[model samples]
Target: MTAVSQMKCACDSCLCIVSPNEQAVQKDGKYYCSDACASGHSNGEGCGHTGCDCN
Candidate 1:
């Protein structure tokens, strides 16, 4: 299999794809597509991504 360079957001319900070259949020060694996910919803109520209920 090809080497994996991109990954889905660390948030359990998020559907965003995160790439090393992209400006994604990093928290506790995990990659998140937005600050809401990185902060574990501390800054906001949820991930805010469509169809995602990460909170």
Candidate 2:
């Protein structure tokens, strides 16, 4: 059994091309499996906050 959450990370990245979003879930919206994958957007790390939260 898994948690009642569905997160997914279907974004663009060099790694994503060969490797699927190894860290992504679908919790109402797409999400990364870990913070690293979504860390480049927090605190304005060029995450494109205006687009999707990288953090």
lDDT of each: 0.79, 0.39
1-55: candidate 2 lDDT, tens digit per residue: 8553433344343132111344353233546444444554345443332345444
Cα lDDT tens digits, model 1, 1-55, are 8765799988887788888457778788888988887877776577667777777
RMSD of 2: 8.9
TM-scores for all predictions: 0.67, 0.24
Give the distance in Å from residue 6's predicted Cα in candidate 1 to where it truly belongs.
Answer: 1.4
Q: Where is model 1 poorest over a 10-residue stretch in terms of lDDT?
A: 40-49
